[model samples]
Structures are given as C-alpha cells and as structure tokens.
Target: TLSLFYCMVGVVLVTGGSGLVGNGIREALGKHETGEEYDWVFLSSSDCDLRDKQAAVELFERMQPKFVIHCAASVGGLFKNMKNKLTMYQDNMDINRNVLAACHHMKVQKLVSVLTTCIFPDSIEYPFESSQLHDGAPHPSNEGYAYAKRMLEVESRLYREQFGHNFVCAVPSNIYGKYDNFHLEDGHVVPCLIYQAYLAKKSGQTLKVLGSGAPLRQFVYSIDVGLLLIWMLFNYNDEEPLILTSNEEISIGDLAQLIVNAWGGNIEIQTFILPTAFNLKYNAVRFQQS
Candidate 1:
C-alpha cells in the first residue's frame, strides 16, 4: 500500500516561478489534459533564498520533489548584463550550484535546467548545433553571464557522469510574453520596446531605438517555451542539451516596427553606438505537442 501510494503521487517543483518563463511553464502544466495527477510547487526567490545552500537543501528536503524545473537565475537585458557582469556571474553561479546540488542529493527523478542562446560562442556560425556549445568563448559583452550558464551544462554532465543523476539542460532562444521585466534600461528588447511604445503613444513622441536594428534574433513565445519544457521534462532524458528555438528570424528594426504598429506610434532609430555582434539563428526544433 505504501509503495502504491508513492507510485501514484509525484511533486513537481518549479523554481523562479514568478518570472516570465516560469509562469509560462506553470500555465502550460495547468492546461495539460492529465494535469490533475501531479503536485506542482512554484517557488520564487522570495519563497526561499536559493543562493543559500542550507536553505535550498531545507526546501528540497521538506518538499521531497520527484521533479524539478530549475528556472531560477539572475537575468537582465543586454545593457544590464554588460554593466553588471560580475554580479550576474556570481549570483547565477550560486543559484545553479545550490539547486543542482540539492536536486542530486534529493535524488529527484528529473531536473530540467533552463539556459539561453546567449551562452553560445560569439564567433559561432548560424543555425547553431548543440555540439558547438563549449567550442569557443562567448561574446565579451555578456561573457560573465554566458560562462555561468555554460557551467550549468558542464555541471549537469558531470553530475550525471559521476552520480548518475537525470540532470538535463534546455537551451531556449529569446523568450517574450506576459509577466516580463519592463524596466526601460534593464528589460529585454520586446518588453522594453513595448514599454517605450506605450510611453511614446501616451506622450505623443516618437519611440527611440538604440542600435542600427540590423542584428537578427529568434524570439520564441514564452508559452510555447513553457510547453516545450514540460515535454522535455517527461520525454527527454539525456545529457545532451536540447535547443528550443523557432526558425523565424526577425531584425531589430522589424521587431521595433511591430511594437510601434501595435501601439500605433512612429519610431526613431538612433545610433548611439555601433551594434554589437549578437546575431543568433537555430535549426528548427523537432518536437511539438499535438
């Protein structure tokens, strides 16, 4: 009877649950057809300071989660990452280390950690392959953050190799959707443009864009990323990192226009500085849920 009870029940823990990607995963899980069977726990930074190892261990021990979606990390926009490289590096390293260690110690059935395209080498070719992850150095603009995430992949593989843990990594492209950070200087492109457009429309001013708007990027919808994460949690069980990205590539200019058109405002392109080399392209991900 006790074994039957264990088999029938499972706890799913989602860290950084208040953020955009975390919220997306939680919402997708809610809409799943068989979602009623598992227990899901969403933990934001406020729930427990995961940067603290003892606190992370205490939380894991108390929850005894069989599944963990490790989404917690120190994230910011291009400028923020560039300016606060050290902080981003240290904070994310602490969070990832504590969470992954806890997951291994607790013997969680599976742990899917989220990563970003920014971790790829700055000089890597387009249509990025998973095999080229650690081939070269990442862009200098955000190397601190990139290397921190890069280590997650390394740590995941090492953990699995040594302890035989089911620790996997998911690499997603630029994600945009609801609950995103809208800070003018520290937010991602999409949310920041949206906010700028909103302000421009309200004040009857032309929206200003920072760069030449030539760099290309693939922005996956947060909800779509969430669904994919859920699928990966159950369907994917390997050490190789899964790249989750769309094939549609949009220039910064077009993306800004889209935002302006949505808000019914005109845009002004200002070349404050030369655009950095941050273009990203990916082969279409093969998985989908019908």
Candidate 2:
C-alpha cells in the first residue's frame, strides 16, 4: 500500500509555532543530522487566530497542509491559572473547537494535538499510563484548563471512531526547556525560577518562589516530547493516546535545585511557605506513573 517513491513529507501547519512545544518540534524535525527536513508553516497568535471561525477557514483554504500539529492553548503556572479560570477555559476551549472544526472542514490528512498532564487527575497511578487518564478528577486548581483538554481528547477520539480520521492526541507530562516562557508574570516554574533567580543574583537581592516547595511535578524536556510527537505521527496509526513522558517525579524544592544546578551552579533559589494544599502534595506524581 506504500511506495518507495514517497519522499516528500506533507506540509506542516503548526499552531502556536512561537510557543515552546511548537518550536521544539520544529527544531527536532529540522535538525541537520538525522531528523528529515520537511516543509513547515508557522502561525503565531496574530497570523491566524483560531478563535475566529472565518480566519481559521481562510487559513485552512490557503495552504491546506496535509498535516496539522496543534500546540496552542492558554496555559501557565498555578497562580495565574487559579486566578483566571474563565480566561483559561474559554481561550483554550475556543482554540481547540475552532481549529479542529477547520481541520475537519479542510479534511487535513492527519493532526497531532498536545494535552497537559494536569488533566490526568490528582490520584494518578504511579508511572502514569495512558489508560489511567480517566481514573480520577483533575486537580481543582487547574480543573478548568483540564476540562478543556479532556474535551479535546474526546473530540479527537470521536473523529477517529466515526470518520476514520487520524486525529492523534498526546498527553505529555510537565514540559520545560529552552524557549520556555520566561516572563515574570507569564512563565512557568522552570523559566520563571531560573530567570528570576539569575536576575536576583545579578542585582544582589533575595529571590522567592510561590510555594512551600512541596508540590509534586514530573517534568519532561520539551524536545523529548516533540520527538515523541513526530515519532508517533510517522511510525504508528495511533490506536491509543501516547504520553510523551518519563516516570520521573521531583519535588518543587528539588526541582528548584535542579534549575539552580542547570543554571550552572551560580544562583541561590528560595521558597516561602504558602498556605496552598497544592504544595503539600509534593512527590504525589511519583506513584502516578510508576
């Protein structure tokens, strides 16, 4: 059913190409040594807003990429998410609904959508498997965002089951690496901690993190997750949801230390005790994927 003459890879349309995961996938795919270079088109928040039905349709009609990789969503750390529930829910929900609807309209050959590990609930089994996704309710702090991602999973599943489509969904663990959001208000734990600490070190001031440093989180490097995405898209039919992660869990305190080490052992990182239950759950994810 396949031919050796098929050398040209499909044109790739990456939503949120400016974001960490999208950028990571691009680098992984375009690596000079081994990863085959493919034609790719990047769209940021401005180029084509998925929230607009007309714009999404117009963009889909123009390039008509045979493959679409959706890495776009409104996501951030616990503080921002807890404060802005409606924004997170509405923004992420709109993006997925409009984009997936456009893909169905354009009939793109295949799609790869990324979801967060936060959607997998608090009582996650150790070494969390893809099968345990539906085991428990999501963490309350991020329940809104998690609900949107779960809806994404369901929509993609329906497409595959009813229409025989290739809408692949990947649920990756907490991801971090280069190009991660480093903004003081917008960045996640790793970038925020590293950059803020580096600044504090340079300015000779005290640095503080939000929690008591007890929250359990599992982190995967962005590129590793990207590689897993492309691998599943190319090599498999994607019968089940694939998780781009390792079962390694780390405490918020220890994670801070890792960044301090990765920051080349130059900065001091400190955490202040917060009254949040999220912090008391450190190492909770250790048994989640084990």
Candidate 3:
C-alpha cells in the first residue's frame, strides 16, 4: 500500500509548459488551491530538447516526478503540416517515444498524454469514438502529424499491456484561449482569426479569411480542459483514450463574426475560397467523458 506521506509529497511534471495548454493547466492549478499538496514543475523547450532520448531520461531522473502530463509535440497549421511532413512526424515520434520510455523507466504512478481531434481518420463517421481511431487513414494534408499522434496511443496501450504502466491519452477538440499561438500563416484557426481581425480593425480594412469558412469545429476553453486533466490525474486510470471537447459546433465564418463582435463589430469579413481540394470539413462529436 502507498503511504499517505509519500502521496502528499508527490511531484507532478508538465512538459510543453510554455504553450497554450500548459498556461491553462497553470491557471487551473492556481484556481483549485492545491499547490500545497504537490510540487508542480512546468518545462518549456528551453529546459531541454525532449527529442533527445538521453536528455529526456536525464530530465526525468532529476525531477523524479510521481505523475507526468505529456503535452509536448510538434504542431502547426494545415499548410505548414503539408509542407513539413517529415519534420512533424520525426519530431513528434521522438518526443513521445522518449517521454514514455522515461516515464516507464522511472516507474511513474500515472501519465496523461494530450492528443488532437485531427488524428481521427478523415473518412470516418461522425461523433468519433476511441474504438474507431484506426478505422481508416487520416487526411493526406496532415497525415504525417496524425500518424505520429496515433502512434502515441499505440505506445500507451502497448506499455499498459506489456508493463502495466498507468498511461492514458486525452483527445481534445479545437482548444483556444489565452497564450495561444497567433501566427497568421502557421497558427491554428481561432488564434489566427483573432490576429487577422485585430489587424483588419486597426487598418480599417476588410478581413480576408481563407476557405469558404464553412468547416465546423468544436472548441473547448483551455482552462476547462486543464480542470478536467487535473481530475483525470487522480480519478482516471483506464487505457482507453478520453475525449475532451464541447457540445456546440461553430463554423469558421460565424466564429470570425464573433471575434469581430468582441472587437466592436466594425470590420467586414471577406471569404477567400481555396481550391476544392484544399477545403476540408471537420464534423466532430460532442464531448463525452469515459
């Protein structure tokens, strides 16, 4: 049996601590008032390049954490994914592989790895489920990144079955909030739109939005995801991946309008329809807790 003293003094390490989700987790930890119970360490890329196996193992040894939340990965927008498939696949695979190996080597009590809804196959049915992950191939544009993420799930399950490691995965929908990447060409949807809207409003020009703005996406607040992750750390242990998302789905056009409304609703949005092949629609299911 685990001793109460050990549990109370446990350490929790969070990788990719400088990114959007990491900021959300930090906010959630402060909101819950549980800082006194466990020592929390948030690691950014500056601390160590997780792609290096030796560096990863050394970091884990130094932290000696009881719980780990693996949020580090190579992420970018659609065009970037298409242009740099090899880099995305190689970098993410390395980070995930090394992290899992280190966690198992140290005998960590539990681990939760964050995943994206984009990893789901493009031709699958609506309302994605954990069981249908490998049903088909992902969209070609982001397949490299998707497959790498899929492998993370595979590694987690294998580790559980072969070594009995308490490793699990969390699949979240389009997550947006403070500290998000706002790069116009390389950032995700929401942040990119926000940035464009800001520039358009300031310059008094119409905002040029790519695509038909018809793709449906489900977005969850980062802080909400953070809260759920904390709950999962203590109460969730199953190997099946948990889906973290919201019920409401919004279109990109309507989403842009909302952002404009927030900024005084003075800028007009112009839709720039891309080629038929480039327009992709993502119809995600509502959030379901496992």
Instruction: List the candidates' TM-scores in order.
Output: 0.94, 0.85, 0.91
Which prediction has more favorable lDDT, 1 or 3? Answer: 1
The candidate with the higher TM-score, 1 or 3, is: 1
The 10-residue segment with the lowest total lDDT in model 3:
276-285
| lDDT at 26, model 3 | 88
Off by over 4 Å in 1: 1-8, 266-272
Instruction: lDDT winner between 1 and 2, please give it.
Output: 1
Candidate 1: Cα lDDT at 99: 96
lDDT of each: 0.86, 0.75, 0.85
Best by TM-score: 1
TM value for model 3: 0.91
Which structure among the candidates has the greatest lDDT? Answer: 1
Between candidates 2 and 3, the one scoring higher on lDDT is: 3
Candidate 2 stretches greater than 4 Å from native = 1-9, 32-37, 262-268, 275-290
lDDT of 1: 0.86
Residue 15's lDDT within candidate 2 is: 89
| Per-residue lDDT of candidate 1, residues 114-148 (tens digit) | 99888898887777788899989999888889999
Prediction 1 TM-score vs. true: 0.94
